[model samples]
Target chain A: MRFTILFSISLLLTGSRGFAQQRFVLEQSSISFHSDGVIEDIAATNTNVSSIFDASKGEIAYLLNMKDFQFPKKLMQVHFNEKYVESEKYPRASFEGKIVGFDPAVEGLQQVNAVGRMTIHGVTKDVQFPGTVERKGGMLAMKANFILKLQDYAIKVPQIVWQNIAQQVEVTVDFNYRAQ
Target chain B: MMRRILPFVFLLPLLAHAQGDLLDELNKTKPGTDYTIATFKGTRLVNGHTIETKQAGTLEFIFAHRFGPLDGGVYEMFGLDEAFVRLGLDYGITDNLSVSIGRNSADKIMDSYVKYKALSQRSGQKSFPFTLTALGGVAYSISPRRDDEPEGFETVDRLAYTGQLLLARKFSPRLSLQLMPTFIHKNAVSKTVERNDHVALGVGGRLKLTRSVALTTEYYYRLDPPDNDVLEAQTLSPRYNSLGFGIDIETGGHVFQLVLTNTTSLTERTFITQTQGDFFDGKIHLGFNVTRTFQLKKQERR
Candidate 1:
């Protein structure tokens, strides 16, 4: 009976330690999107995205204000918020998901995939994308590049400006996270 | 059984808080207040200025035209034969400050002005209700000579100065209103018959019809009308209040404004004090303004 109790205690301790969630916060990050239209090429970047990372459970969450996106041309920024995003009605875009194939003990650099629901313009969809995650010393950095189809999220572009904006946009996300 | 139950107890807390903790971290920081943007389609509502100003390091090129009164009859081709043009360049030094220089063909006049945005309207945590801008402008007549000059128009006497306060409110995405309290000073005027100073109140409104189109209107009423003797001696058509109607069309980086107004002159110096037409009468003029904006500096998101 003593041996059974010892085994139970040891299993419970190991399970608790493995399942414990370790919180990490975004230190510095950049999220950018590029649209290669037939007539014009447009791009915007955002640095004010709020995010939290869980290294043990390999989970991630991101929340960003649509108006936070910055463009080289101020008019484009206004059009993005007013006509495209309708930011007044839906001011936020968010993503919450899990990162697979990330092993903290293995450290170094590893290839991983993030599976999550990305919400934009008040529309949400399931997305799975590949990324590179590197753990160096005390910080973990993630870099990802993916192509997003606007129609998939119901972000429609009027026919008049069809040549001004592309139907598919390439989005790049880079983030450095540190333990909280 | 004890080992299986013990492991579940430890794992339950981790699974339950997975979504909750991340959500809490995000809710901790809400976005700052949202400032109102694109209150009016263009910088000019109709004949007068609007609360709109160019963003920092942006340059705008304006080409405008005003034709003679529609009542000029067929010989004038319904006024299209007589077209006065104005070319202007406006530059934004900052998001809230801008300066412009322009020359109008009507009186061979040169105009230079500065505008400052004092307050912005915002909604959210600490909100503001209205937008305000202060504008000061000076115009000079470069004409060699005119039969009816304000004292033969000497170098200094050709100058006129104007000051205005633009107050505007966007009641909704579709409706916006503005009120302008204007003051003008002329370097010289007919002795006692015409005062050197004039005061007027202008009211304007814009109704957005679509994402790319809007309707705008403005009227300026003079508080002190010059005496009849000043008008008759100057050989001028009786001075009347300025009234205008405009349609704004926006595409890509260009803004086109179609105007119908009783005020023929484009410069505030003459339009505010020496308007010749009456909207009630058939003295309306057709005009148009087209502006294109270019970004001079890169504003990258950091």
Candidate 2:
């Protein structure tokens, strides 16, 4: 019994894995993107996002429904799903990554490097973004900003509406996670 | 050995946990219930509604123009000399309901209608296979009195009513189809042999070719034509079925659709029952519809 107890204590102290793993689920999140075209500037935001973070191992993943995005013009939203992202074939976009330098026990804001694979329009590519994470009394808040190219995910912009949409877009991610 | 094996027992659970991916864990918490969107791009496919409603606080302005028949030839400048126009405004009272008012210059006709989306196509936890919308409208003609009517006609004689149930499904990202079962009632008809009641079934489809362009076609088949036995000899008009094909080009806030249709009229009461030319007989009219949508109210504040 004593030996078993010793192993259990050792596993608990290791802190990164096993039965003591810390998993946090998203309470709220906002993912927004802006496309600055020559003729028009378009922006959209999706608050209906699902995310979970394994703080113990610094592993994180988030998913968002492409159709959930809201644009200023309703027609723009339709075109985004029906044409740009082909949301019928690919309903959701996701990111799976790890925070390189985030310490869950540290109770202040800290800058971290997030390296991951981002998938959109049924295409996946490696991505890296610098982010800020703040830990407060068992809560974790994260925010990230990055630039993404339309061609990176095979999201084609036809020549006809090329001036209405941009090749490069700026994306912002904000998430708040609570212990599960 | 006991000490080492005890540690192994502790390590076993961690090994199994390590085998799982973070994305798998995220997927478990994903909420269910997703609504199908963009079943059709705009309010109209080519010449009729396509089970689409503007989100609340949206206003759309539609301008439609039809030239004379393409068969009119060079003497008529390929129908450019003849023009019939209609201007309409539609507003969304709610996310699922909208109202529209328009005027057609050809007959000095005024039209008003309301569209309600009773059911939306959806997938996921709760799903529906098709979208269903209820459409009801009225058309009024205010033309000058003719020699046939020495006295002006009664106000009631100028009125016509229409009702339709529109059903549509998006089978794929590239294809969508719609069905409109329509009922129309006219208070007056020039011919006594013509039935005051009209019934028709309209079929429409959209095929996406490029990112911003699509091909759309609509056909309205009349179920009840003027009594064949009573009016076989009386040639009021050809009254062939209405058929149209269009190309939809969408920009950020505008939709420009070019159409080739057999009918010059642009109202539900007229187009569904009064098409005067045969599509195969080279009686096609060139037309275009330009629609611009303005966000009057924010349905969802970003």
Candidate 3:
């Protein structure tokens, strides 16, 4: 009888561990801008996501080939190589942040903060964003929302499009990381 | 008399022969030698040019897909939507030269022309990093016309030509713009009045509104008096040539265009026609074009 009880407990522990391991990736991740009078939006998306951990201290990151963050159609794709992001010169945009007050034991759901440095268009800024850390089954899901201002990142929104584009752009980041 | 006359006649024949040979050589060479074939993909469409692309030797399936269906509805009555589909193939005979043949969707008009990259914005990759410029071939429309027209009317049914120049620059990741200067020539004006060919300046651009959607607009201005210059004789007041405005929403292989154009003619030539009641009264056209790219058979490479 004792052997049966111990075996059951061990099985539960293994099941929880599997749920805790999570990995989420966005095939097309982008932040867009829209405003009055003019209808113009810009989206920058490339493979940009990183692994997350609980209990143990680990870093999470998001990367984007700033050069690859294409504009509208082929126009952006062609001139993109030479003009804007200067992909040939400055290859990538990245962010490195670690989860704070993160604990896997508490279970359920809890609000946490991720402190990190985000580099965009070659400029980096320190940011502290609030996110919900979810522990479900054996998976970990992190969802956060933050505002990113173009001027802050030194991304000069052109005057021609000044009226169309907003000075401050809103960004949302959601990641689900599973155990490898 | 015999010797002198013989010598004169022989010389005349020789001169004619020489002239004929020169003419023949000129005919063999494509027109617009000095101009570059300034054809990039039309900014109106997402893919760029309307010309069908060919790879290897066979027709590339992707190229075939570049051209959408041949749609002719009642809109053709007012010449509102009279377009066939044209896929042009350009060949580079030399590094600095290329020639192209394009078929129009309306009337199946075929255009053959040559372009020269006289100068490129990207010279050796470093000269002008921000701006690109090119001067090239003028496009000519060559479609067979009916020999006879109904009685009592003038026929403006002849091949027309246009010289186009393309210039583009990117200000940043979110903004980019292009300018095209086009000169259009027509043999005869509408039956209403007499006028010369039309010269127009076009400005177009693509702004990334979102990752998948873009705000696209183009404006055409006749450097000379608009077609309305002829209209004044009949209407007391002349009306300006049609102005075009459109937006392109692209997702995957599909492109949907919401346009507010005074004229519905898609081709550059047809739109140049001076017609009334074609102007937009807020009644816009919603056009959607979807292109599917596929790999062609190994033997189909062109």
Measured against the true structure, the TM-scores of the candidates, in listed sequence, are: 0.88, 0.89, 0.43
Q: CAPRI band of model 1?
A: acceptable
Query: What are the per-model DockQ values?
Result: 0.36, 0.46, 0.01
**lDDT for each of the candidates?**
0.85, 0.85, 0.47
Please give, for residues B91-152, the per-residue lDDT of candidate 1 as tens digits. 88999999999999988999998999999989988799999999999998887576655544
Candidate 2: regions farther than 4 A off? A1-19, A159-162, B1-16, B145-152, B227-235
* TM-score of chain A considered alone, across all candidate predictions: 0.87, 0.88, 0.66
* Candidate 2 per-residue C-alpha lDDT over A69-157 given as tens digits, one digit per residue, 9 for 90 to 100: 99877767777887788888898899998989988778999999999999999999999999999988778889999999999999888
Over A127-167, each residue of candidate 1 has an lDDT whose tens digit, in order, gives 99999889876688999999998888777777574468988
lDDT of 2 by residue, B142-178 (tens): 7745544446577789899999999999887778899
Q: Candidate 2's interface RMSD, please?
A: 3.7
Give the candidate order by descending TM-score.
Answer: 2, 1, 3
- At residue A70, what lDDT does model 3 achieve? 29
The better-scoring model by lDDT among 1 and 3 is 1
lDDT for B102 in candidate 1 is 92
- Candidate number of the best DockQ: 2
Worst 10 residues of 1 chain B by lDDT: B10-19
Poorest 10 consecutive residues by lDDT, candidate 2 chain B: B143-152
Instruction: For model 3, state the Cα shift of residue A174 in Å.
Output: 35
